[model samples]
Target: MQRTDVNTLGEFGLIDHLTENFVNKQQTTILGVGDDAAIIAGGDEQIVISTDMLVEGIHFDFTYTPLKHLGYKAVVVNLSDIAAMNARPEQITVSIALSNRFSVEALDELYAGIAAACKTYGVDLVGGDTTSSNKGLIISITAIGRAPAGRITRRSGAKVGDLICITGNLGAAYLGLQLLEREKAVFKDNPEMQPKMGEHAPYLLQRQLRPEARTDMVDTFAKEGIVPTSMIDISDGLASEIFHICKASGVGAIIEESGVPIHNDAQLQALEFNLDPITTALSGGEDYELLFTIDPKDTEKIRFLPDLYIAGEIVAKEDGVKLHTKGGNIHPIKAQGWNHFGE
Candidate 1:
């Protein structure tokens, strides 16, 4: 037998190679892969389903992350995928595997966050499962949502010349993570020095610890009477999600660095970390903001929308994906998003 290493394929590549042989046999299975969420047939509307897993050491660290925030984030990430489809999340199922190190009180704290997120997002906690694990805590959340007829969006619908748009800001969450790691290292060396983050940068800390999905943006699109040409949520960074849209839609894009939204605090902290803010904005993951494209004809409707940035435009595939810098420089857009398989 020939030995194959999983890291060579990477996360997305491994998924593609593994599931390539699986067949979608049912008429109700509208989509299978290569998109944010799976589309399924409903009586009068389309049902969007998406699942995400957060492992103890891989996705999060208890040394710096609170249980409540972790639980909330686990749900929000999947809901963000639902929002990427331009759908409103309806319910979620949470499954947890924990080791003996956790107490019943710990589980209560986690569920409390899940309940709060459910209320905030206007969804119900339908059902889930529980199990034991020897390693550490693992959470898997599956979100279910519905979209109105002909309203659901996907990565493959973007058209040439479509305006690429993003909601809220980017890179703050990544910066927050960096800050937490630094503090964690300090605490490991000297346990007496506890990590206190709220005093300095509340906004950036919140963006990482407890990020809210852009479900409100889906509402904004509804109120504005605009359907995006295509859509994806920025979980893996702007450049990575852009590649998803371009590859799925068979188009390229050119985004302006000036147009990419970055919060003032995020930029300040990026400098503290000795990093370029724009680089973090492009490569940082877990912002949970939306990255979408709209038809140029309907662009006027969203012009007045708050915090909505028209960052770029979809171009023909031959043009290649590029980025225009604030200093009038153009370069190829590289995918530096989160990779589960470490390089």
Candidate 2:
């Protein structure tokens, strides 16, 4: 048999091929293997299911990425997808593939973080699979959630003139990863040297190791009577995720480059890394924040929102998606984001 490279299939193609013949026997599987999560038909509320996979070299590095945090992150990443759908995650299934290198104690530490997240978010660990792998450790998590049938958000609903908004700040995670990589290099050379994360400790280090999904923001919308016209999580960076929303909604956007939020510590870290903070904010992945749009009329609702910021507004397709530079130049916002395969 001839061996084929998986990258040739691409992520989307692989997903399609793997799920094409898998029929959903239950009527509850109204939507599956597509969209942000599987939308299930239920009584008054709909159930949403999402899964995420993290491989050693691709998703994270075990040398610095402690097993405990890795387990927690694997769970949170999938929940972020659920939150993107404006659903409340209720349960998760954690599956792991391990080699002889890991001991029973290591597994316990990993589950400790998983249990911590479940407790923090009020979710349960329903069930999952465990297997031995010849390579490094792998974690795959599936989150099951719920929301009112009409209240669920999707990627294909933004209308012209809707305001584009995002929660918290962006770019920190990518820069944080860069910092970690630098430290790892330094440590490799001098094992005696302690990691000098310095003042950038709390925000950057926390972002890289223990990122939290914006489920609280989804819950906040309920309290504030706000429903996003379209929604996506900033896992693939703001510029790329904004493209996903625009592409799905058949609309375009104009984001004020100056209006995008960046934290002070994150800015300093970016400067130290000799990176463009704005570019990082635009293209950094794994932020796990929410990017959404709302109607012009409801703009006031989020105007005073403490954690949310209006980055821009949706425009006609002819207007095209763009970013207004500080120099007042309009440039097309290309989705030159992290493509794990290749550009």
Q: Each candidate's lDDT (Cα)?
A: 0.84, 0.82
Model 1 CA deviation exceeding 4 Å by range: 1-43, 194-200
**Tens digit of lDDT per residue, candidate 2, span 313-334?**
9999888889998789998999
Q: Which lDDT value does model 1 have at 224?
A: 88
In angstroms, how far off is 50's CA in candidate 1? 0.4
Whole-model lDDT for model 2 versus the true structure?
0.82
lDDT of 1 by residue, 1-343 (tens): 3435434555556445433433444454566555665555575788888999998888899987888898788989999999999998876767777776766557666777887787788765554556668889989888888888688999999999899999999999999888888888889899999776653378888999999999998889999899898999999999999999999999999999999999999998888779989999899999999999999999789998998999999999999999999999999989779887653
Kindly report which residue stretches of model 2 are placed more than 4 angstroms away from their true locations once superposed: 1-42
Model number with the top lDDT: 1
Q: Estimate each model's TM-score.
A: 0.86, 0.87
